[model samples]
Every structure is written in structure tokens, then in C-alpha cells.
Target: MDTQQDWDIYDVTIVGGGPAGMYAAFYSGMRAMRTKIIEAKRELGGFMRTYPEKIVWDVGGVGPVRCERLIEILEKQARTFDPAIVFGQAVAGMNRREDGVFELTSTTGERHYTRTVILCAGRGMTQVQKLDIHGANRYELANLHYTITDLSRFAGKRVLISGGGDSAVDWANELEKLAKEVIVVHRRSEFTAHERPVAQMRTFAKVLTPYRISGLYGSADRIARVALTHTETGEPEEVEADEVIVSHGYDRDFGNLVNWGLEREDYGVSVDAKMRTNLPGIFGAGDFITYGSKVRLIAGAFNDAVLAVNSAKMFLEPSATDMAGVSSHNERFFEKNKAVIEEEKQRQQN
Candidate 1:
């Protein structure tokens, strides 16, 4: 619990409370590191909060787990290590000291000192791109949404989604079973998403591409029609709809972290095989700091946590070598925390 005006030192200070950050915190605890996780949200699980009803399909060693269940499991795993958790605190700035420690200053003027820093912010700090169309602002609050969290509300309703990426296709597929009619419009001719979800969506929904959403036609209570444009001929058309979902990716605001001498490429922060950034004591993992190998999946980010934690351990103890041997240590750590893990599993089942 770090309040403003007092500087509390920790072994590692992890930014963001997504899957990557949560896993990093768990590993930090396993290594017996005094860690603190700083999250902007009131609770843990970043985008997991965005898909409460969606099923998580890619988590390895796990069945198609519910998003809420995954969140509970990850939260429990993160806490099993007993790391000091800080929520609703956004990092305004950060700097690496000459002594190799990282100093983080939050928007609330809270300052944290730690031997290492791991950023797992993901795309949470970014702004969700929207279809800048006529009458967009009116429905922006009432009928328009940037992300999908729960699908129950969409059942028996007509939904129009804009975008051709994995998100748009995934949502289209998910809503197909629930919603009355699902329509997906993409600016690009070809979908950039994986073939599986794309195929699934095409089986049920109307998939149109190389078209842009031009305007919103609706009354005060709900959205009724969506104006669209053909990319090739500039032809315009309108489709009736109940709700419009825009998912064209996002733009990030790294904030003053850009001034902290952090090593980041256009993709994200750069880190080595061990998740060690260019700065010795400053490390990054997950979507925020992957160098060349960027896997946006939660499972991939969890692997990044393994590397980052190992690197943090070696950095704290310079005499350490062969961090590969830390795997047994990790197993022991998980074993010690098995009771909590079992509790979460039961909760998930119940």
C-alpha cells in the first residue's frame, strides 16, 4: 500500500494488471522478491475485464475457460506469491537511477523505488479507434461500444460490427449464436484474422469488406441504420441495425515513460530472450515490451513473465547463474500455493 508523498522500495514494480503483469507478479513472489503491482483499474485483469462472458480459447493446458474464470485463476495465482498490490494508480513517469533502481511516479504523486520494472500495460493505455462518421457522437454513449465484455445483452438483437481484424471476427462469431443478425464490415478486402474464426463467422454472419462505415442513422433511444461506403466504386449504402461496434485497434499513450530512457521500438519496449530490456534493471514483458517476437496472446505473455522474472532474479543477485534451473523453484512455488489454486478452480466450476 504505497500512498502519495512516501517512497516505498520494492524488489520489482510491475506496471499494468493484465495477464502479463499478473503472471510476472506471481513469479516475483515465487523468487521471494518483494514485489508491488501498480494498476490503473480498481481490480486486477486488464482486457479480461473487457470480455467477461467470452470464452478464452487459447490458454494452454486449459479447456475453453470462461473469461471471468480465467481472471479469477490468474488473480489467485498472482496473489499466491503475496506481492503487494496497488490499484487505481497510473504511472505518470518513470526513470532509471544511476544506482540501477527504477523510480516510478504516478499521477497521484505516488513514487515507488524498485530494483527492476516490468511493464505489462498491454494496449490498455491506448484509445480505441472509432468510426468518425456523421451522428457518431450522439450514439457514442448510448448504442455504440468500443469493446465487447458481455454478450448476454446482445442476445435477440441485431448487431453491426466494423473491422476485419480478429476482434471483429471473433465478436461476430460469438454474437452469431446470440444476436438475431450479425453483420461485419471491414475496410480491407481480406481479413487479417486467423482463418478459423473468419470461417466460423462467414458460416452465419454477412461478411462484407473493403467498405467503410460512413454514418449513423438512429433516433435518441437506439441506433437504427448504418451508412456504409464501397472502397472500390465509392458507392454508398445503409443497413438497418440495433447496435454498432467499432474495433479498429487502438493508439497508445506511453506518457512520461517515454522520457525515462526506456528502450522501445514502434511495436513496444525491446527486451532480450530473458525479457531484459536495454536498461540493466529495467525489464519489460507482455505486449508493452516485446522486441522482435510479439505474441499478443495471454499465454505468450505468461511465457514472457517467466523470462522477465528469471532476468529480475539474476539482476537482483548478480552472482546468480543458469536461471534455467529456476524452473524447479517455480514448481515448488506453485506447489506451496496449490491450496489457493484449488480454491479458484472450485470457484470456476461452481
Candidate 2:
């Protein structure tokens, strides 16, 4: 299945198709730069697609839009610039060559040689961390879902969400009106979510005491009950529910770019305000960069994309003479690849 290819040169190559990467592509297009977006998954909108039904509480300037709604808007804006996007291709390795260009190798064995590399790949390919309870695996592909991709299906059903972070609270608020009953389970005494959302959830849904999910009980095929154990007293209880939604955050492992030897500040790639990494042509935006005042919101990522694109543009054209030609070439590339650039999707049904 590997359609391996040699290095495809690009002005900027953005890894990960999340909000950050999407905006990066858009900004690159606005700057008239030849850019390519590579996403591991078949679809765009990385984490946004993971919880399309949940309400976005953090995106400032936009009032509590549904995750899927934001994805649609961002995807549309990203495509307006007309950039080549490759799906189902995960970045396997990246390195700065002696010639000052980045050599990026994808998991599918495709090569991309780019003048600048922007790592907007937030959370580096996130997946739900599941609780390995008995009977959980059987329902995973059916009634049970680890991440809240669509909340409409649970409109009238009783749903129990596990986790205390912002994600758990976001779902609780988003599905309170949709679901018949929403119960939040947190292992700690205090909520990890923002104060406003926590207060809102208390008024709408039932916030459970400090407890952890013990196991899941089911009937012939679907989940029927969830067992919980109190953190302090160790008291056990069982609750009947129609669905179990686990929002216990995600595990981020950047083994793909670990060998690049880039400077690390607080376990992330060190970057300036323009999202430029320690390496001359390498930059990291979104949640992948290390900085004192870093914002991980979708809007913040978009702003970062602007800065990174501008820096990349200047880097590409150190002299003012090449600027006009670069812009013209990028415009031509975008117009020619309009059909091939947009609407690239891959699906995995296993």
C-alpha cells in the first residue's frame, strides 16, 4: 500500500491537519507560498474531529461553537488558499540537511523537502486512553465510544463521563441538554476544568464525588452498568447507564521527530515568537512548542501560523529581488493544483 515517492519540494510543509496546521496552510497560501499539509489520519481537523459534537469553550471571539462546526469553518478557510494536502500519511522522521532544507520522511515512505517546516501537529496524533475494564472492548466498536465524536446519538440516553479535565467538563456542558442524564466522575476532589465551565456543569448536570471507574457491566452486547470506587473511603457503587463516555485526555508521544536533535525547552521544541525552532528553517507552533506564554487554543495557533509564515517567507527570500518571483510561482502552483489539492480523504474500516 506504500506509494513511496522522492522528495517533493515545498516552501513550507505543515505536519498535522489540526486547527494549527489548517491555519498554517491558509496563511501560507495568503503569503503566496507553496505549501503542503500532511496528516496521519484520513480526515482533516485533528482533535476537532475527535470531539465534533462537544462544545468548544476555549476558543475566544467565537461563542461556544460545536466542535464540528468550528472544524467546518476552519477547513473551509484553510482550503481557500488551495494547498496540497496529503491524508493517511504520518511523519516518520525529520532532519535538517546541510543545504539548510528540511528532509521529512513520512510513515508511508513519501519524502518532502521543504524550505521551512512548521510543526503544528498538536498533541502529536492523539488517541483516547481507555480503561481496560471487562466487557469494554466488546462495546467499543458499537455503543461505547472513547472520545465524543458525535453527541447527538446520546440525546435521550443516560451518559456517564469519566475524567475531571477540561475535556470532561466541555462534554458535560455540551451534552447536558442533549442527554437525559450526564454524570461526571473525577478521581480527585477538585475539578481540573476552568471555574466557569465547572460552575455551569454543576447547575446543569450531576457532578459526582471523588471516584474512579472500577469496571463496566453489560448485557448481551451493550454496556448496561458502570462500577465506581470512592477515592477516599473506597466505597463501591454501581450505576445504570445507556452509554459510557471516557474523556481522560490523550497521550502525546513525539517519537516521529525525536531524532532531530532540536533544542528542547521543557520537553518541547524551543521556538521564538515566530514559531521558529532552534534550527534555522525548523519551526513549531501549536501545542508542540515550548515557551513561557504559550497559548494552545485554536485561535492562538492561527496567530502563530501567521508569524511562522512571515518568518518563513523572509527566510526563503533574504533578498528583496526574489520576493516577487516566489509569490508569482506560488500563485501559479495553487491555481494549477486547485482540483488535486482539495478534498483528499482516506478511510480505514477494520
Candidate 3:
């Protein structure tokens, strides 16, 4: 494992742990650059972690992969480079020093210095909205959850999903197959989710509209039922439930990056074709960056990562190769995995 003392300065410091950041770490390793990824969340995957059960069909080279599975594969690919990964830390501030190195400080007081910085901090800081019921906090440790990590946990249980957004409806649809009974409670009469999924969810799950969870009722350790009130009629009803999922969406902001002196759009930072920000020695990628005709897809973010990493590499060392060649044909691949490659080669020869 590479430690702070192992290198005087990192070749690249990636500011996010999403798909773009993870791929950048891998590519940086391919380029033999010392790399570190700092993520604000306790785990990697960024927004993907929120809806781990969601099926992803847009990512390249994979068909109908789950969000959690994609993240697992991406994380494994990133680990090949052994990049130093720091979780639960948010970049609080950053500055370029006279020595031509960038210094970064995290909210936790951790400091990192790197030759070049890659801004992959997608949507800056993000947080899931929580259930606002009076006693919801008491059951949070037990049956109440803001995010679903495992679908099996809901098996045979009665699940109550709150909210009308895409994630809420999606989870309701997914949990309907695992749970004994699934009920979707929304404050508004109409759902805000995409029409197709919402229509599909209605076919499997009981949809309760124009109603809000008025009160949570149960033991201190777990939730047993909830009281719902009609949004307009103010009529009350009770529903038996084993678990409640709050998917009110997220409260995401650009956070400290808004004040970082970089050119900004209403969405995020602005970058050029090379993924270079207005600041030298700094680049941006993924959902955190804005450009003309940006696709805002995982594949597009990956392209951004490649451009950013290559630009940063050349910026740091003008003599460095403009881009790392194909991994299958690159000498660095064999050099780094000599034992495994040799073993595979011998197995093939036999």
C-alpha cells in the first residue's frame, strides 16, 4: 500500500470516487502515476450507491447490469493500480502553491499534495432525503432505511416506500417481488417519476397517492405500522409494514467548489475539450463538469476521465507520453503483472 511518505507528491489526486474517478485511478496506474482518490462518502460509487438495485443499461460493454454490480466491477478494476483511497473525507479547500504543486485540505483536516488534481466530485456533495415522521429517527437503527443495500433483507416483509420520485417508484417495483406486500405512499396525487416505470409499478405495487405519512407507530427498536393522512381530505388510515424506505430524493449541491474560483455553470464546473478547467494543473470530469453537448452518461464521464488524466499528465511532465497505449499491448501491463502474466502464458503454452 502506498502511504503519504512513499512519495513526495502524488501524480494525480482524484476528488471523487464515482465511475469517472475510479477509471481515472486505473488509467493513472496504467500510466505509472502515483494516484489517490478522496471520496466524501463512507463508501465509493457516489450516486450509484443510493440505488444499488437499479438496472443500468447504458454503460458500455455490459448489458442490464445492476448499479451495485457495476460499482463492484469498477472498484475491482480501480484496485489494480493500488491507488490510495481515502473515504469519508470531503475536500474543503484547494490551492496551487508557488512550487507548482496543488495542496488540498479535507473537512476532516486531512491534507494532500499532488502535481495535478482531477475534479470528479460529481454534483459536489450529495445526501439522501430522510423520512420526516415524528418517530422515524427511533426506528432508523432497525427497520427504517434511507437506502437499500440488499434486496434479500426485504424478503417476506411488508415494505412501505415513501415518495413519488423515480427511485421511490423503482424501489417499490423491485421490492414488490421480494416483499410480501409493497405500498407506495406519496404526498402528491401524481408521481414525478418517469411515466413508464410508474405505470409498471402500479401493476405490481399498491399505489397510495395524495397521502403523506402523518405518524410512525411501533416499538422503539422497530417500526410496525404507519399512519397516513390524505393530503387534501385530511382523512387518516393505518398500514401494517415491516420496513419503510424513504426515497424523497437527494439534496445535492456543488458545495465548496462553487467558491473555488473555477468557471461554473448552473449545474457544475466548466471545462474545455481537454477537460482542463480555468485553473492550470486542475481538470474536471463526470457529472461535476459541464461542456457543450455533454451527454451526462457513465460512458461520457469515462471519456472525460481519459482526457483529464492525459491532459494532467502532459501538464505535469511535458515529456511524458500523451496517452497510455492499449493495456493488452502495453509493456507496463506485463511489468506490473509479471508473475500472473507468466503463469497464464505457461498455461496457454501447455
Candidate 4:
């Protein structure tokens, strides 16, 4: 870990590397503030990274964008200002300094200081729920996948999806088109996902309800089959599978934020319309923020990020504009990005 004294305090420190945090980093650069983004994961994009193949349609202007593609675009946009980014570091605690700067310590023992902080740490650290059956861990990397980073891995394979949630049903529907066979096993008859996709999945994929995964079996290196037991009758059944997708859902926690002394609800941190939390110089946004009429959508999170960044700017410099003008007409932006813009235009012209 680098010594804290060796580093310069940033004008803004954005937590979490999801879309909201990434956008905040970009806007902070537009505001000409020195910024840094800290993400716990090895990569950016937050939960979207787990669903790389899923298509995102709600974000305006970008129609039907693949999850991986959107994340790449957002990462590029965030890097426009070249903010310092640290990955695989989870913030463990924070403190306010006498000079009004914030000091953050990570679980890795590294420290960072900043003028202000944005808690875009969406749902904090999240881990996918895994199968409890014996020998499950042995096949985790071989054949059992909690998330789909590459959809082609299941191509022409027999896939078994264990869960009744939206992700499970969605993956089943998606894999049905590529996989040789797709089966969905759930512990309950009723699914927890939206009805439309579930109904669509029934049309193609085999649905086995009121059943729980009992065992996993195969060679020492790979999983070839899974045993399922009926939830009501205790009857057992076996299915041959080339891959297993466990989408039971994620176990999420706010990590150190729970002890940060902020006012929070059962869902997430509470904030005002300005995205200001109860603490001064600290704000919250993304799925981890809660406010009246707040919608849990990527679009909503983007709006939240903008509001939080603008408020943070004002908090840093009272005379600064509350809102930035349109990027298209901003001469300073064009000047800063003149070469890149010109190159893009040249490419289009060709």
C-alpha cells in the first residue's frame, strides 16, 4: 500500500465503478476537478459486468445495446478526463479531516484523501448465491457459472439453470437459442421473475419446478450431471448437463457505509433531491440511494449521478455553476477533445 502522505488529495472521489460512478467521474472532469474512482471489483460496470451478454434498451439514445458494449462505452466516456482509477479496492471506512477533506481507507490498507466523496457504491459488495450441494465448488470454474461473461461458452451445450428469478429465466431464454438443451430448475412452482419472460421461457426451455439441486457429479475436472430432488415428494431425478448457471440472486451489503453514520432505510441510503446525504461533503446515488419517487433504473441512476456531481461541485466552489451547459455546444469541451473529435469525424467521412 502506498503511503497516504505521498498522494495528492483529489477534488472529488467517486466510489463504485458502475455506470453512475463512471459518469460522475466524466462529469467531474468536465467540471475540471481532479477526480479518482475506486472500485472493489477487478473491472468497472458493476452488476452489468455480470450480465455481459444481456441487452440494455432503457438507456436513451443507445438502443438495444449489449451489456458489455454499454460498459465499454461508459468506461471510454469516463476516461475522457483520465481520472485516476483504482480497482480491487473496497473502501472500509472514512473520516473527515480538520481541513474539511475526506480520508478514505480501503480493505487493502490503502488510503485516499479527497475534498468530497460520492457514494455511488451500488449495493456495496455483491456475491452470487451458489449451489449448496457437495462438490459444487470443484466445478465452479469448470462447468458451473454464476454469471455469464461469455455467452458462447454454452453454445451447443446442455445447460441447466437453477433459479426462478429474472436472471435465471432470462438466461434460460437466451441460452435456449444457442444451447442444445436448456432446463430450468426451481425450488418452488411459482417463479419470482416477471411473468412475460417466464411465459416465454415455458414455450421453449424445459421447466422443472418444486425441485432443489441435490448433488453434483462428473469427472474430477468437469461437471457432467446434476441431481435434483422434488421439494414436496423428495423424489430424485438426474439430468445430463454440460454447464450449470446458478442465478439464485446476489447477497449484497453496504459494507463500511452501514457504519458511516449516514441515514439509511431498509433499501439504501436516503438523500435529498440534490443527492446530498445527511453528511456534508458526502452524497449518494445509484441503486444504493433512496428518495421519494426514486425509480430503480439505470436511467434514474444516471440522473442521480449528475445531480450528485453538480451538488458536489457547488459544495466545493460556491460560485461554480449548478448545472453544466450542453456538451455539444461547449467550446471548452470541443477544444479539449478537438483531436479525438476530428479523428472520429475523419473516420465517419471515410
Query: What tens-digit string does per-residue lDDT give for candidate 2 at 1-350?
Result: 22324446788999888988998898787777889998888989987777776678788677889889989888987897678999998897876666676778898887777888888777787777888676578888767777766667898999898889888888888887889999888999899899999999999787778999998777766888988999999999898889888878788767567667778766467788767887788777787776777877777787777777778888887752322335445654566465544544222321
**lDDT rank, highest first?**
4, 3, 1, 2
The number of the candidate with the highest TM-score is 4
- C-alpha local distance difference test of each model: 0.82, 0.80, 0.87, 0.89
lDDT of 1 by residue, 1-350 (tens): 33323246788999999999999998887777889999987899887786676788899988999999999999998997688888888887877666666678898898888878888888746567767765576777777888766677788988999988888888888887799999999998999999988988889998777899887777884688888999998999889988888889877676766666767787887788888877777777788876666788898899999888888888888776534445445565566667768989999999
Output the lDDT of residue 92, model 4. 83
User: lDDT of candidate 2 vs native?
Assistant: 0.80
- In order of appearance, the predictions have TM-scores of 0.81, 0.81, 0.90, 0.94
Write one digit per residue (lDDT tens) for candidate 4, span 1-350: 33456257898999999988999998888788889999999999997877888889999889899989999999999998899999999988898978787889999998899999999998778987887776688887689888888899899999999999999999998887899999999999999999999999999898999999999889996888889999999999999999988999888966777798999887789999999999999998899899997878888888998899999999999999998877887665777677878899999999
Q: If both were scored by lDDT, which would come out higher, candidate 2 or candidate 4?
A: 4
TM-score of 3: 0.90
* Of 2 and 3, the candidate ranking higher by TM-score: 3
Clashes of each: 0, 0, 0, 0
lDDT of 3 by residue, 1-350 (tens): 22456375899999999998999998888888899999998888877887787789999899999899999999998889799999998997988777777889898988888999999998668877777665578888898989888889999998999999888987887876789989999999999999998999998898888999988888878889889999999999999999898888888866676788999887778999999999999998899999996768889889999999999889978998889898889887776678778899999999
Q: Against the true structure, what is every candidate's RMSD?
A: 4.3, 6.8, 3.3, 2.2
- The parts of candidate 2 lying over 4 Å away from their true place are 1-7, 56-64, 203-207, 320-350
Which model, 1 or 2, shows the larger lDDT?
1
